[model samples]
Target: MSSDLPALILGVLCGTGGTIGYVKTGSVPSLVAGLGVGALYTYSSQRIRNNLPYGIELALLASTVLAGSSVPRAIKTGKPLPQVLSVLAASGLIYYGVKFMQRE
Candidate 1:
């Protein structure tokens, strides 16, 4: 298998695992939201590294905050927004951080 395949599989597994875990614990909404946010973060990081004219880091932070804040809400009210936001933010951070580190 290719190296990228591992990363991709890991990502999917993480998301699936989180969802299953949350559902089992009756926190499905939160899991959904967090996953959404995480995906967003990942995408944003790529954009930033691509040299898009935007503050990728800030966007990532914002998404993170949004998602993180949503988790509690999901747990209490079964809402998924918080989780989604959190995931997106995390993805953004990861993307940019990786790109920045790779810069020559």
Candidate 2:
């Protein structure tokens, strides 16, 4: 599988989660963050796939945003969704961070 596949999947999941949150609770913030971060992840995936610049950086940024937002919520609420998101986003951070460092 391609390395960017994970980021693409993460983007789709984030978008879907955001949409679901909006539909269920009318959370405009959730919708906006979801779609916005999803778009950023998607763009980063494309850049990585094409070997373009800043792909890893962008992915790292998106992951950091996701982790930053979700970790506190997970700690505060003990909710499964935030916990899962925190784990996924953290994984993305580690993965992309390593990729970024490995680049000469």
Candidate 3:
């Protein structure tokens, strides 16, 4: 599969998760972080699709942030959502990280 596919999926999941969090708990932070990172992932995915610059870098950054935040939450809360997000983010990190390295 293309590297962009994972980013796209992550973007959708993040957006959906964020929306759900806001609707269920009225958490503005969740909404903002989710939508913000989701947009980044989406834009990066588009960039990657178009063969533009920094696509992998942007995805890597977003994935790093997501992993950093979600991993701890997953560990602390042991919730399914956080755990899932953590896994996806970590996967994105590994995927984009490898792609980024390969480009050099």
Worst 10 residues of 2 by lDDT: 95-104
Q: Could you give candidate 3's per-residue lDDT for residues 1-104 as a string of tens digits?
A: 99788889989989988999999999999999999999999999999999999999999989998998899999999999889999899899989989988999
99 Cα displacement, candidate 3 (Å): 0.9
Runs of candidate 1 with Cα error greater than 4 angstroms are 1-20, 55-58, 61-104
lDDT of 2 at 35: 94
Find the 10 residues in a row with the least total lDDT in model 1.
1-10
- Against the correct fold, how does model 1 do in TM-score? 0.40
Candidate 1: tens digits of C-alpha lDDT, residues 1-104:
32123223323544665587687787876477446544544444455446564435544454455545655676678756446534644554575456445652
- Off-target runs (Cα >4 Å) in candidate 3 are none
TM-scores, one per candidate: 0.40, 0.96, 0.94
lDDT of each: 0.51, 0.92, 0.93
